[model samples]
Target: MPLPPTVADLTSFDLLLSVARLGSVGRAAAAHGISQPAASSRLRQLERRLALTLLDRSPRGSTLTETGALIADWARAAVEAADALGAGISALRASRHSRLTVAASQTVAEYLLPAWLVALHAGNPGLSVTLRALNSADVADRVLSGEADVGFVEGPAVPSGLDSAVVGADRLTVIVAPGHPWSRRRRGITAAELAATPLVSREAGSGTRGALEAALGSAPAAVLELSSTTAIKHAVAAGNAPGVVSSLAIVAELAAGTLVAVPAADVPLQRRLHAVWPTGAQPAGPARDLLSIARRR
Candidate 1:
């Protein structure tokens, strides 16, 4: 008779690897939808069973020790093999009904996803989609936790445990009320000049805010932190302060002359829009189909 696998053998080694990669026990627990203490105890149990330490823990973060690094490499190989088998099985079972849930940052949700959704629906009438609009960080979190089938964000980098591909491009444009000083200037605005002026901005965690911070070297003089792009545009138009926003979001305002798009010497600030999904979870069925539509658009 074959010997039974031990408790350690039954524990998911994949979880351990993911925790190492993400660098925080809390984040890892959230990704798996378990309590932090449970995750910690499991890791300890695994360590005790293996007679090896896998992580160096400090308040700063966790890092894989030497033995952990070696084990992690092997674990990754096993995960790849398992994923391949799972993919083959999933492909075989593709005829079954499956739902796709997608979460997108506010700008993409407001401006881009509706068109993509219409196209996706035309192509796959049988597929159901649930769409949620959130900030970029929340979109990534939902994808990593399996709560969202896919995510679309505009930002600097993909959060750990989620893979992202740039599906489109967008630009951040500085705008002012038609009467503002910069509206008539038309050119010669440097980064320093923009920095010195009081700016209306989105609150922290917004993808637009992240892009602006990256371009401007620090947080702007946020005279007002509004939640919605529409609200920000209204504030700018009321002459509250100059604001930066996605070019797509302010299209109607620009066209109607309610707001003026200021020209900066080197500053049609461009940013890449990304489509993201969990690193190990391949897009399938409706999710795969939607991704294709988004990419083409």
Candidate 2:
């Protein structure tokens, strides 16, 4: 098996993950503060070195191949681990000054952190922020271990050893392709009806999956278990299976008419998004400010 690209060959795994997430080199480049052509050329170079087509380029956008999708997930994990290592080193060097480190689950990291970080910067220009994106369990671990000044999670009760506050709410909604049978129904479907159907669901341990299981009182027969909201949306839009997802994750698809939210008899499967930190510790300055901004948003 040939390698896709060595770490040395790419400036950062951030670029690759961004391309995977956004599905366009131009968008990925812009997110990373680079030029579109530069991003395209780098991806092409990686493809050449691997001797495999990593992306399916179409008029609408780029889509990852099966292998590319798997590789992208691994790359994202590696990149996140690298970031954690760097933050650890920086913390050691700084020793005692005020710095804010946050650990957040994927949904909050992707959809909410950027705006919160922006607000934090504007409110306190002198403070530094380090953000880590992980699953709910890991977020709690980081806060407990003091690796993160604060943690945000989308799942159930906060893990022990941490103090938590509900900063916001997220609703889990069932969605299907616009042409799917469920979309034609004006009346909401019962939980039993949904439980009998095949569904695309987040993998176990995901905040979304946990909330859905709580809402339905049992897991639906999963046709597919995906890691990212984007992949789940694409699978649902292709009519593979109906999906339970955060409404925030599917806003673009719903707006574009690519997917439709199915009305559930138990509407708005509510989940509290919590901001957590050590039980005895207080978050002041930037961390406090970021939490305040997130609540307002």
Candidate 3:
């Protein structure tokens, strides 16, 4: 059944219950943190909507009439139910505030999340955080399945059925062992040539592979499909094959001369990193805080 407009405002009903208990509109208004005139006006509006004379108002005080007392009795149950609902909502919010589950792609997990998590914990010392490092596709799956409160993904496009914001950007690097023939090349490699050549690569479903495929406009020929940037780096450094990975992951190797960056002039190697959650459901509590830290950096 549709609620009548007058009975729709729970606060007004709550005010009536207060007036019934306190025996004075002025006293009830004080309890509600409103002035006497405001309280009286609300009661008058309620009475007009219900078409009942609820209060016997006197110069000395106010008292509920028979109809008013009956209505108050019914409203009491509803008020109690509303209180329970408020309590349940508070409990859920507190739980979320104190605990967070996050799923992130390898690049974000390895190179980015440490700083973000540090800042998140700094602000929320009591918060318990769990982090899962997976490929981009798996991160999306975890978020969609409600296994994670929020997810970070590195890909050219966000997965369907998730809402996202670009928290950061990264560029893919093609690296080779110092002895590889590509290391000594004077000019940048074109996308077609890079695609035609077999390279060490991250496995399918990883953001690094997805971005490489998107940039080349076709899947690059892979000599081996390893799962981690570390594995790809080790393979490339051992002269197995050239590998494509995040520039963020290769800083130390590049500086140490173990790996050399091979420029891809025609490929769009840059990709955005996203923070994602279930569609239409905005992140709150600790999840929101972590997202803020990611974007700020």
Candidate 4:
């Protein structure tokens, strides 16, 4: 509904109170950063709109009439309510912009998120961020359920119902102990051999596992399944079975020869990493800033 004309122009009501306090339209106009004539004209319009004279104007000055004084008292409440409303909205915005919660796949959380978070904090000093490391499917669930402000996943396909943007790309490396036969092979193994062989692998919800299955068009047989990439690396190094892990996760081990990367000749091992959020809810505030940092890198 439209506001009543007399009460709609809160500035004029404010000017009336100022005139009552300062004892003149000229003084009120000066206080409100307007010319005396403009202030007088606004007051005239307001009086005509309400059909009530709110100011007694004379060469000496302007004074509030008895009815004008009563109206000013009521206007004070409306003005104060508006001020409170503004303050409340500001507080809500500050809360939203100052805090962020993130959920990410284990590969991203362990290898990529630390650097991105460091950059995010350097730019926004007082922002608070919380992170949860889960498998790719859990990351999507966290975002869709509103338990997290944003999520990062390395799966080949994004979960249904959430929007996503590719933030980075990663390759899944097939790794084995230094003594394994594949480590000594003159050429990379084919996808059929890699799929046919039982391997130590991450649990089903993992992005690494998902990418491998998607690339091979079926799930590979697992000799053992572990949740942590670190654990899988240790198992592979012990000559238990070859395992697939993010290239990022095995950098040091590959350098040390604790694990050797065995490539798949026919399989596409590369996957894109993504930032996911609920549909129609674009990231804002610190979440948006963190995503920007990810994309830049």
Q: Write the per-residue lDDT of candidate 2 for residues 1-297, one digit (tens) a residue.
A: 764446544454577778888878789999989898888788777777667677888888777788778768877767787789989998875653457888998889889888888877887776777889887888888888889888898886677888888889988888999888889889968888888888998887778887787777788889999887888889999865799988888888889999998889754498999999889888765677777888888
Report the alpha-carbon TM-score of model 4 versus the true structure.
0.86
lDDT of 3: 0.92
Q: Give per-model TM-scores.
A: 0.67, 0.64, 0.85, 0.86
Instruction: Give the alpha-carbon lDDT of every model.
Output: 0.83, 0.82, 0.92, 0.91
The best candidate by lDDT is: 3
Supply candidate 3's per-residue lDDT for 256. Answer: 95
The segments of candidate 4 whose C-alpha lies over 4 angstroms from its true place after superposition are 1-16, 21-51
Please report how far candidate 2 places residue 225 from its true position, in Å.
Answer: 1.5
Cand. 3 TM to true fold: 0.85
lDDT string for model 1 (1-297, tens) is 653443325335776877877877778888889998898888887788778898898988777789988877877876777778889898757643356789998899999999999998887787778999888888988888888889999876677888877889999899998888888885647888887888898887888888888887777788999887888998999975899999899888889999998876664379999999988777877888888988899
Model 4 / residue 237 / CA error / Å: 2.0
- Candidate 3 lDDT by residue in tens digits, 98-201: 99999999999999999999999999999999999999999999999999999999988999999999999999998999998888887968888899989998
Pick the TM-score winner: 4
**Candidates arranged by lDDT, highest first:** 3, 4, 1, 2
What candidate 3 gets wrong by more than 4 Å, as runs, is 4-7, 184-190, 278-282
